[model samples]
Target: MLKRLWLILGPVFCAALLVALLLVFFPTKLRHDFEAEKRSAVTLTAASFKGRMQKVQALTDANHRFVPFFGSSEWLRFDSMHPSVLAEKYDRPYRPYLLGQRGAASLNQYFGMQQMLPELENQTVVYVVSPQWFTKTGYDASAFQQYFNSDQLTSFLTQQEGDAAAHHAAERLLQLYPNIAMADIVKKVADGTALSASEDQFVGLMARINKRQDIFFSSLIPSYNRHYDQRVLPELSRLPDEFSYQELEKVAIEEAKEHTKSNDLGIDDKFYKKRLKAKLRELKGAQKNLSYIKSPEYNDLQLVLNQFAKSKANVLFVIPPVNEKWMAYTGLREDMYQQTVEKIKYQLESQGFTNIADFSKDGGKPYFMQDTIHMGWLGWLEFDKVVDPFVSNPKPAPAYHLNSAFFSKEWANYDGDVKEFGNK
Candidate 1:
């Protein structure tokens, strides 16, 4: 019996040992192949992915203290060139890194910070948060699980203690297994390789991907608008045009239900409208919960804020500016917007975030393209106008300095420079 068992186990044990040896010996190549395949399979534009990856790489490579700008696409629209321009304008050095992704909500941003905490722990962090982030419903923690699982992110989070980091990391890992696995593979491959890419490659890739995402999303915009007008508007018309608050509330609830049921890809006005309404409800709830001082989300945000405040890192929370037309079209009232702003201010002030700046109320021209959520160059320019100054003259306590060494080199090669702005 012992001889038979040894024979059966011998081959299995040898195979396992061989595989371990391979991993130990050719880790980079194996990791590279895995990453390349994973990246190639991603449906989003390559430039976007590259930009995000670059930020992670930069963080990993940085020996000096660093500051990162965090948010979704709205913040992504910030032109790196504008920082140089702003630096020239103010005659100050500018060191800013963009860490934004399209379609990312508030929860996503929170998770991003958690995953990036390792490199970010002692660094300055500026967060561009919108009320929309607070208003997003359904805690789809899974949305960010894959991101948290990446080797870099996992390594970073493991080093961070406290309830928030551990709780979020565990929850996200379980929810986004495939993503986590993919990220791990990418990190394993990226290890030891230069974190930075060639300037030309970075810009070329970003422009290409931006164009692709725009073209894809733009093609769908007209149809979405048409559907909103013909189908959704008519249904919403069933409610009185000038409705009382209670009547509007009833309409919002009923419309949300019907919209969820009629969900389709062709034209999803009801679906979009429903999400907007749900977000509004969440904003209102944040306001109510603020009075009580016991809201879990609010509390969580406060905890992170406190952590940020005490660290040597400079932290700023920026609220991205949105198109006024979009707000009006979505039936958002001025009072509603103001109340939301007030709530945000209260939260920031209560948490002692004097370095914070909220731009959600910035009354700028609609820089977004028609029927889509992305910002065009003009919008990006406007975004930079607000951000360049702050980054150039970062608050003294956090002690963030612009790393022009990274900027003046490869960044100058890209189309992101101020001179190339109108050519496109």
Candidate 2:
């Protein structure tokens, strides 16, 4: 009887001990080893934008502080080799962590902000905005989802400031047992757990999982974790280095040659006048009064600002200029665009976000842009100059410039008698 009892008790004790060891060590080791692999992965792709973000995320994860400049392709010309606005001209001390993706408008920036939130709390961040983003179309779904698509992100974004605990708790739950929640739902569905439930419930669960598939990496990955680097491909290391001044010059020359060859370079004096007249005609024909202030994109912008207000991050918003030539080609009026700027300014100032540089109506300076949208080197230099004082220490109440002197209502063929657009 004693031998039989010993046999039963011994096996039970062994099983309990094994379970304890696995519980304490397995997950921890898995996370640790994965991060170790990620650090090596970063060096493999350091030159690429995704790799740069990964590197910064890792550094932030490690608790190292750095400034962040968030925007779209328009800001790609920003020179990090120079001193940040935060530093003295001679000091060149602060290193900015630039976060951007092509066509990343307002909504994408919001999601990008979400991506970097864990590391950015209480840090200084420079955010760039384009007026076109306020238009009806706003950001497309693909652009927004490419950077931010995850179950945990949905919870964090939808919650309030006081729900920080809930946000963190939700994040921990998802990271610890990924796909578990979804799996349980699937099991319940199979077991007829909600047989009488509405169609919306089923649709919602499937939608949630579908959204999860777009996430290349979840926000749960520690910003500094080296193991997180494994998500990057080794081939990324082979990418070319950052664009050099010489390379830009070469590209510009090539583009000019192509333009001349294609007769896209119109030399006749009447060409621009005809083009402007045609654009005015088109604008008049459309007859759509764009209420940009009430658009969904503006609502998203408000959400972004609200998130910033809740955090400890010091925010600076830059409103870059659009090309006059491109504006006409696109059939967008200078006056209407000016109105959009005012609406943005009013909304931001109302929310106490007054640190804005309104270069949106800068008479469409050709030197400032490569084309209608992207900044050329001179444009970036101008941006750097304007941005410097704001980022510096001994911080003063930031300056605001409407730059109306650089633009005219006459360009849009608006009656000269009409009042100048302000924050009305």
Candidate 3:
């Protein structure tokens, strides 16, 4: 019986040993596909959002250029004129490597940048900042916890001096991650205390291990979202033989009309029927009391600016408008909405991060928003018009003069004119 058992387990043990030997000896034995990396440039899955290996690979690829499109659900809209589809259909000079999904706000995006600092250095990036993200309470803890990677925190803690951004990052992590795996280290940073020599050694060691682990396992995982796979490639067939804004907008309008026929709100039919049609009446005036003027997001946004400034990245910040009819139905104030836009613009311009595609006043235009607050139809076409030239052509690098004061609670709560950005 013992001999038979040894025979059964011996081969398995040897195989495991050989695999371990290969990992320790031939670390580079695992190969990756650049084609998959190309496909992943358009993949907007959560895994792709957090994984840095795929991003570094595509961003560094010599032949093709992939710009990082940092935003939330807007990227998933994937309408005929969406940035990704349009880029592929037109065979533009660059492809977009989308980096966020639902609930991925400034706080989530800031930390996600930590692990890819080297790749991001000097790269041009597009960030679509949504006004809807700014609320009275700021981002939800559960939501932040869901999209953030622990390795990202490890990378953050390893490089931080517990400065204002570091302090705020540590504090937010403390709140969102009550029992975080690295709570002890995070606590020290939050308290403005340095990690002990041993803690430093531990962090450095873990960083090495995490780096290797990420390299080893990332390829095993598919970077593509894998949703509507059948439709992703065939989408190219739907585009006009050549690029024409008038022709494309007509298609966009046609699509918007067909998808939004079931609702007066101009929201997609399936989304309306399943999500809003039943609650339509109750939603009226429900958003009247909500305010975007005061929130921690302003400070959270400062962290992103600080990162971009540090990296010297050429960036285009796209500020989108909400659906005006839906806003009126819900009694949301447009003046207040404009104030939010102005405040965000002030934060960007005051620091010399000046390239902006402000569509703040375009919400009232027909079919501009797919739903209450996301871009659609003519909105995307107009967006493409502005964005295409910016990315297609070269521009002078921005000179950022970052102010730590933006991270203060005062600025986070301030809702003043652009001229009085700090005076208020």
* Top-TM-score structure, candidate number: 3
Considering lDDT, which of the candidate structures 1 and 2 is the better prediction for this target? 2
Lowest lDDT block of 10, candidate 2: 404-413
Model 2 regions lying over 4 Å from their true place: 1-65, 77-91, 151-294, 394-424
- Estimated TM-score per prediction? 0.48, 0.53, 0.91
lDDT for each residue of candidate 3 in 1-424, tens digit (9 for 90 to 100): 9899889998999998876555455463334455676688777777778766777787777777888889998887767777877887788899878888898899889888998888788888889999889998998988988887767878898888678889888888888888887898898998999789999999887776666666666767764546435435666777798788878988888888988888787887777798788888899999888789999999899999988888889899999998888889999998899899988999999999899999989888888988778887788899999888988885656788999998988888887665776664
lDDT by residue for model 2 (190-274), tens: 3334423553355455444433332223233444533223322321232224534454444444433333232222211233344
- Clash pairs detected, candidate 3: none
lDDT of 1 by residue, 1-424 (tens): 9889979998999998875555344322111132222222121332333223333434554332234666555533222122222232233343344455565544444545543455565565667665554442323455444333233343333333434433443344444453443343223233322223453354344434433333333223222223223322344334444524355345434533333343222112543465544565444323322221112233334435544544555666765544455544444554555555555555565444666665556534432221124333343345555565566565544433322121121221222322232233
Question: Which candidate, 1 or 2, has the higher TM-score?
Answer: 2
Worst 10 residues of 3 by lDDT: 23-32
lDDT of each: 0.41, 0.47, 0.82
- How much lDDT does candidate 3 score? 0.82
The per-prediction tally of clashing pairs is 2, 16, 0
